[model samples]
Target: MSFLSSNPRLTQNEGLAPAYNSQSEQPFAKPPVAIESYIQDLIEQRYQEQPEASVVCAWDGDFTYRQLNNLARSLVALLSAQGVAPEVFVPIYFEKSRWTVIAILGILHA
Candidate 1:
């Protein structure tokens, strides 16, 4: 016999599982916040705490937050000029290197 069938209480109360009703009262609702604002705050914190800290380290070279941000902006401009839509998923397949870190940051910025 099945495990639930072995326990009568489990079988009888199976339909009483927690259900989410949008029309009903919500106890966990919170104010909405912009993701970009959060990201900017994190970036600012990193810069202020460790301005020279290596944010991306790879086989080729390591990058500080300043470098990564600059590279990401350059990449965003280049991709935008080439008609790369913000909604597009640009696939990046490459070996581990500084370029990989740049690509990851670039995608996030895009």
Candidate 2:
């Protein structure tokens, strides 16, 4: 089957992500996760479920969920040490790369 047939949410939502379902074993299955849910929580869940899965593939390198989580956590610690407050906007300027992905996750998690 084509990707659309295998993952109907793409067609159903017109490119929006499918709701995360905790009870479903399949990664793509529909669940009741709110669209406004914290991005960190989603990443943590994905990290827990598939630590070795690739979360980023950039010109520099491919980074797995485990690496992404670890790097993001490190950034979080650094931000905390620097007294970065929660909900504060942390602007990131970079050409898209693996580090950019890590920065975004780090800022979201910080």
Candidate 3:
């Protein structure tokens, strides 16, 4: 069956709001997940298993974790030279391209 048909009640106006609300109300609670360290641990594990695996790939080329890290560092340096601070929200308006990917990675690394 199609997704919309499977959840037929959602198609009705009265059924829409509470069905959404019921999904969100969970009595049991779990510990909050730490995402940053989790991501770092996964990266470390991947590097340990296959040091040559690519982390970031673009239309121009594939960049390994080490290469992306180095590129990010260099871009961060360039951004620093232009007086961008750690907390500053620099608006990046650009057409989608490899440079945009590099800029995003650079910002994350910074």
User: In model 1, which regions exceed 4 Å deviation?
Assistant: 1-41
Candidates' TM-scores? 0.55, 0.65, 0.52
Ranking by TM-score: 2, 1, 3
Distance from true location, Cα of 1 in model 1, Å: 44
RMSD over all Cα atoms, model 1 = 8.3
Better of 1 and 3 by TM-score: 1
What residue runs in model 3 are displaced by over 4 Å at the alpha carbon? Answer: 1-32, 36-51
Q: Of the candidates shown, which would achieve the greatest TM-score relative to the real structure?
A: 2
Per-candidate count of clashing residue pairs (backbone under 3 Å) = 0, 1, 0
lDDT of 2 by residue, 1-110 (tens): 58678786652354444453332337555666668667788889999999999989988899999999999999999987887768787888979788998888888878
Q: What local distance difference test score does each model get? A: 0.71, 0.81, 0.67
lDDT of 3 by residue, 26-97 (tens): 523555666766444565467567767787667767777666556767998998888888788878888765
Ranked by lDDT, the better of candidates 1 and 2 is 2
In terms of lDDT, the poorest run of 10 residues in model 1 is: 15-24
Error of 1 at 21 (Å): 40
Which of 2 and 3 is ahead in TM-score?
2
Error of 1 at 97 (Å): 1.1
Clashes of 2: 1
What order do you get sorting by lDDT, best first? 2, 1, 3
